[model samples]
Target: MLDEAEDDRDAAAPIDMLERYFAAHGWSHQRDEDEIVAKVKGSWTEFELRAIWRADDGVLQFLAFPDVRVADDRRGAIYEAIGLINEQLWIGHFELWSSSGILLFRHAAMIDVEEAALSLEQAEVLVDTAIDECERFYPVFQFVLWGGKSPREAIAASMIETRGEA
Candidate 1:
């Protein structure tokens, strides 16, 4: 019984570390049960982050949803474009919540109490990766939804390399 209780605390230690990290970073966040909801300001769009500690799986997962929501008519194109973009990504991937037509970036990292002390830093890396991937591909989403561009065209337009610094 005592061992079981200790295991429960160990499982929750990562979440506790994440919550403290959010507070220390001055991010306005609310904790609800086992999840933390916060807002992240990105270069291309404002993103809402939902982080949940799934004790059953012993992993911390994060979902970053941008301000833009896809329309029903554009879902297919957006989905195709996400597939292309996700291929280029090293970690995390874009996904559309079909029922709601909400697109988001998702990623997860495994955790244990031994690494709980570094949870705060690891969480930051996960958050940064999610935000960077979303911001990088945000233009493709806009092109497909508003510009009426094909998936390939949108990806090409967004991938154009800059020649020189500003």
Candidate 2:
């Protein structure tokens, strides 16, 4: 009975649920303490997703880092692009790590400690949303970084919606 209680407690941990979700999807991941790092491949690029569960605070902070870097010359434009991009997102936001010029999408969800567990569907949606946002905005960053386009131009170019195949 004691062991069963312990099992239930372990199952309720957010990090453990996230780990199981990653494994079920066959994504490469490693868990250390209260964090799980996984590599997810998106249409535009691959991303490194790091989810940290703070049980004390009952917050799950998830960050998805795309395999793109901002150049010193393009930092200003990139920052502007991020601002515009973030405005369109209903959930999560883009961040540029100034020190490293690394770009990432970050979101945090508050979980009720009493409940303690997130449904597998919730976990999937959390991860999918991050990846979807990254893929959606990747080309905007690329246009600014490599194409030397202005922030407005980059946003416009990336926002074009095509209905069917050419």
Candidate 3:
């Protein structure tokens, strides 16, 4: 059994590890209380990666926001695309903030007390997964929003696997 001081230290360990991870990668980040926000440039676009550590619940919620906005008229199509995209994802899910019409990817992991700390590799994987998924599916959203393609069509186009470069 650990005392309050030890418990508190354990709770903050993940965030501190994340801070170090971000700094090592040369990603610009800001830490506020239990949250850290970092700016990362993905292949498709820029992304804002945010992580919030919940001390009481020992949960770490990670989010990646792609710099894309959906128009009011395209919400229905975007929502459909999100469903299709999320279906194929194993770790996280994509969500559109209805009020702001912004698209973001979100995932959460539980850090057990026994574990007590988040490893740097785990932090790297979390961030990489978010950005990779965002980059992979960004054009699908673009196809639906600006190219006037159906959700299925957009997904199909995005799924085309390219071979070795010419």
Candidate 4:
């Protein structure tokens, strides 16, 4: 029984598992041998999330591009707000692609075990957390990008909590 189970585990690929997980959640996704791409809609924005599985490193990375490129003039403010926003994230953080001025969120996990050993729930969390973090901080980026707000002000604006309906 042990040998059979191990064989089964070995037969399942991580990419396949992730593809199935994305399907199970009713998400539209595309996958090749190395990566899977999905579009996730957050409260503030719609973003494309890419999950790349590195066989050699046993690491899988989920990245979400918020579709907002920080303009050259505003990169400074956005960069500062990203620093503040990153401090609040528990699982993933934001990053700026310097060359392209693109802002994205990234979350990664190391699954040293066989691909079959990872459950759909585990994969879901990775995507969910990445999307959630992006949703949470997108407003901060917008505040800095569009509102001409200072980094501290943007962070503060994004952090406001509402208690009840007015």
Best by lDDT: 3
User: Which segments of model 3 are wrong by more than 4 Å?
Assistant: 1-12
Which of 1 and 2 is the better model by lDDT? Answer: 2
Evaluate model 4: give its lDDT: 0.78
Mark the 10 consecutive residues where model 1 has the least summed lDDT. 1-10
User: How close to the true structure is residue 146 of candidate 4, measured as C-alpha lDDT?
Assistant: 89
Model 4, residue 109: distance off in Å is: 0.2
Candidate 3 structure quality by residue, lDDT tens digits, 8-40: 333337888778767767889999978999998
What would the per-residue lDDT of candidate 2 be over residues 3-45, giving only the tens digit for each residue? 2343433545678878877876788999998999999888888
The superposed Cα distance between candidate 3 and the true structure at residue 119, in angstroms, equals 0.6
TM-score of each: 0.85, 0.90, 0.90, 0.86
Roughly what TM-score does model 1 have, to 2 decimal places?
A: 0.85
Give candidate 1's error at residue 101 in angstroms. 0.4
RMSD of each: 6.8, 5.0, 6.1, 5.2
Local distance difference test, each candidate: 0.79, 0.86, 0.87, 0.78
**CA error at residue 100 for candidate 3, angstroms:** 0.9
Q: Residue 113 in model 4: shift from native, Å? A: 4.8
Which has the higher TM-score value, candidate number 1 or candidate number 4?
Answer: 4
Per-prediction backbone clash count: 0, 0, 0, 0
Look at candidate 2 and tell me the lDDT of residue 134: 92
Residue 31, candidate 3: alpha-carbon lDDT: 99
In candidate 3, which residue pairs get closer than 3 Å at backbone N, Cα or C atoms, i.e. clash? none
